[model samples]
Target: MNGTMPRSSLATTADVAVRRTVGSVTTPAPTTTPLRLPGVMDAEGRVDESRLRMHIFKNGGVSPTERGLVWRFLFGMYPCSSTALERPLLQEQLAVRYQVMKRKWQQMLPDSIRLRLNGTDAELVEAVRYFDQRQAHAQQQDQQEEVRDKLAFLELQAQVLFERVTFDLEELQEAIRIIDKDVPRTDRDLDYYLGEGSGNLLVLRNILITYAAFHPEVSYAQGMNDLCSRFLEVMDSEVDTFWSFSCYMEKFSKDFTADGLHRKIELEAALLKELDPQLYAHLVTDNMESFTFCHRWLLLGFQREFEHSDALRLFEILSCDHLELISQQVERARYQERLASKHSIVPEDNLLTEPQAINTDFTFELFICATILLENRESLLRCRNDVQLIQFTSSLQGTLDLNFTLKKAEEHFYNYCKRSAWDYMNGHCRTRKNKDEHFLYQLRSFFS
Candidate 1:
């Protein structure tokens, strides 16, 4: 994870700003030639980078072409924002411009495939090959309808993003297939099965640097295939998908940085210190301290840590609000238990022999991590090995009862930030450290 930087998130601030300005959009320089439709460009015009850094969210909005363009980028698959949202975009002129966009997409696609874009969903699919099935083709008139034009553009988009790579031994046959697939002839509808499009390298590069904005320590590298793939899956419209993916990457930017990125882990360890002085002391005395295992679990958004379906649910839930209760709760518990466990140790006994009761959602939802810690605690205290402690924390996996774990964690907060989950989420803002540190600090007294 050290080599991987966060992907692009450039459009998030722009989307908010653009939304405000859609009402007051200005017309662009008129040109006879088709402007690049699908290529990545700053849909929003320039801003003073230094001054607009934070308030990019409040800037003015889109052009007629820009709205049509941004609409696809921001919402791609989410329901199209109501046209009413763009009521002030001088609708009459914009409609004419959008028609030009339709023509541009047609020019890029093959004739057969282009024809299919005019029909209904079934007709559209029929014009193109599906992943597993083959069907007969159909006929089309020469005249272009507005609906078909827009539909053609969307179909072309679907083909580019959804097309899968093929593996056939005959190189010549594959090449012929590729050429035939691209060129359309006569009245026949072309296969909508996708072909390739030019990679938006600029947008991708921007994604990397912009994602790593906070931590200049990290380099913007590649191999973010999974994130990009998922982005395409959710967003068919190129611009919308790109922007939404940017928003999704915000929480992960820091972790994607270089080895020096330790703000979260450092904070986690700090929370531990504030929580339980005794455990903290024992960990220090034994050279067994710091919680680093949770790094990957947190960094990759726990991709490898949980099952497939569960990952989606996690993303969906995270997207639902600004809630980060689990992280906060775990920090609190780790801190509190540190205090309790410190006093439990006999002078002659190793620190591992003393248990710091963990009250955290992670104990249950991701209870596996806690179990691993507990299993290794005895040895950790005996050897007081810091490196081993780091390794042990990093190895946990498996799906879990997140809500139950949270409930269980709440039970341990009896003397700390004891607010119910609902209350804590709604208004509680003691900075998880206080509640967590208090909990751990009391552990010593509880067992003393």
Candidate 2:
């Protein structure tokens, strides 16, 4: 597993002051015209849900120009059915709300508050414990005047200290400090974050800090920067970028939280046990928690496993939930040809039926994880125990092929669908309806 920098570290007073100095957001000017998806949007710029779904499912990704707009729909930040005219107004409204949320912490931060923010969570907890003990001792010394005056002074200071700590600004300060350290470390190899002042790298950090202020509950998680980097790459406007990232977090925050991380690890373990019993048994026999390796996979959604653009493509496809649509389109085309000629033979291994493109429901990602494990299954099973298994899994950081991995993921998904007796002759996989039967009949009649 990749080492995670903890969010609990304290920052210096100067660092907190620097963050507080920039209180307002500077909206980045639009640099290029937003590209529209052709068939997916009508003349009025309203989305065609079925067409959009099928296009993304079949194509895997949109052009770079069209990606931000497409992702807004995928993330549910902008409604798929919404018109282009409606989006700007919606974004304006969100941007106002976003600024309001961000300003709360900005207004409250001060030098005394900055000093109070410079403690880890454990340190803060211990501070509170010591205060309570001193208070208790103060009660016992009530008969001594000199000690009582000093105790009163100490009690007043403690009350002020706790008051500062209770402000949302304090948490925001801590999160910003952590983000400052982590931002420069983000994707440094890429040209995007390389420049010196107010670059996209700074924008990425701003998004994270702004998000921490807004959610406050999941203030900041370590791996969130990876998720935000992908969002920034797609969405140009900071407001759009921030909201879209928030929308992404809505579904995934649990995977990053304290309790939720463990639960997901266990969930993956149980899923592996069900999907590939042999691999699961080998893992348990070695006494390795599924999370020992699966943590990074789930945390960043295999972002590190592939190239940057490939990761973006994978994320957009996964967000759209259109894989089943593509499968139906392929089957429908094959069925029509078959109906047109009585002897028309569909190849057992048709090119269109292969899992060339992948749709990523979180469940679909689990399948991808399964595929990765199975890809490495032989080596894993050969391991004497957990040590060698962990070694193999951890070393898979930068070596996997996104395309091959996705193809295998799709195969796993299809086979799982098959094992459950997935209806192929039927049009709707989920509902088991023959939606294409009418088209099949028309083709047959025309040929006759």
Candidate 3:
């Protein structure tokens, strides 16, 4: 555990008192503060991120009301150190920027197509360029031939424009159709997703579509709908959901890619092999590869394993970078306080005291995968064949305790860190030529 929490608990009083400030205005405290997760947030409504992270690490997850704002920081949509007052300004700026991007795609239609639909087109350079090229080329041809050629060229240009617009529209329609297929199936058991003509469903669809438009490269993967559902639920506003989802995709979009999946699958197998050699051998003997059972875990970050609320908490703790800058801030403040005290010893008994430095190397999920496989090691070892092993691991869905899993995963990760240090010190680790070499070198340097 990071540190034990304060003993006092709230009954009628607020669990956390955050001063509600918007822009330059500060709202007075409510007569009745709503029940919230104890100590995760401050009186200013800003997250005490380091404490919140450790709390979630020890306790599994936060209350439902706190998950929304907590997830914003986790998703990098909001900085951990940002004040409540700055949030309004930042959100307003992102809202404007989102509009600009959405409008950029919306205005991709040609004037002819836009005029027919009575939708104004702000981007007309393509059509203008086509006419300009035609005029320039026409000057070189015979007058009679040019007239005939102009008609043919106009027809061809119209066809090209129609085809281009048709392709774009087709892509959009496909994305919508895919989203439509998945939206109805998204957490339908929950009352929030149920009911016909739900506005939340519309918001979910729009966020996915907007993401598809922004990232045309990986347009609307199957699991993307499930991913967007959390964001939409957490953030009530459509604009906020869109931007938050976009920010989340920065790290998560890798899972949606073929190469990304392969990398994760490889990493999972390697980590598990290192963490539990016996389990690895059993899996290999049974012909059960990590990809067979671990793909979903990587793609969704174990969202399928735990309950919705628990999964949210697990993600927040996993997303925490241990606040390195905050650690530095603490160090600087300590130095200054000691200096002010005439070189007297400064107390190191603060709640934010650094304990085990977690290797925030994006391998926490790998550790979780290792823990899952290790948890079922006996059952896995009992399996007679690949089918049995695959079936057993496949059945892990919805049966995991987020708190236990995290605790076990952290243990495994600390072991990995030790092994990593040993291997680097002994020059037993592989020397890879890639983008990650620098990171490995840095880790080695830290250890050395």
Candidate 1 lowest-lDDT run of ten: 14-23
Note the residue pairs that clash in candidate 3. Answer: 17-43, 18-43, 18-45, 19-43
Q: Hey, what RMSD does candidate 2 come out at?
A: 15.5
- Candidates in order, TM-scores: namely 0.37, 0.65, 0.61
Candidate 2 lDDT tens digits, 1-448: 0111122211101100010101234333222243465677676566777666556655767778778777776776676665555554455445544554444444555332222322453433343444445435534532355533543443343234333233465676788778866765677666554433225665576578767765666789788887888787677556778877877787778888768778767667766775789878878763665446777877788887777777787777676665455445445664554454345343444313322222223266677788888898898888775677778877887788877887777766655544332233322222314454433332223212
Clash count for candidate 3 is: 4
Q: Tell me the RMSD of model 3 versus the true structure.
A: 18.6
TM-score: the better of candidates 1 and 2: 2
Evaluate all candidate structures by whole-model CA lDDT and list the values in order. 0.34, 0.59, 0.56
**For every candidate structure, what is the RMSD over all alpha carbons to the true structure, in angstroms?**
17.4, 15.5, 18.6
Model 3 lDDT-worst window of ten: 3-12
Of candidates 3 and 1, the better by TM-score: 3
User: TM-score order of candidates, best first?
Assistant: 2, 3, 1
Clashes of each: 28, 1, 4
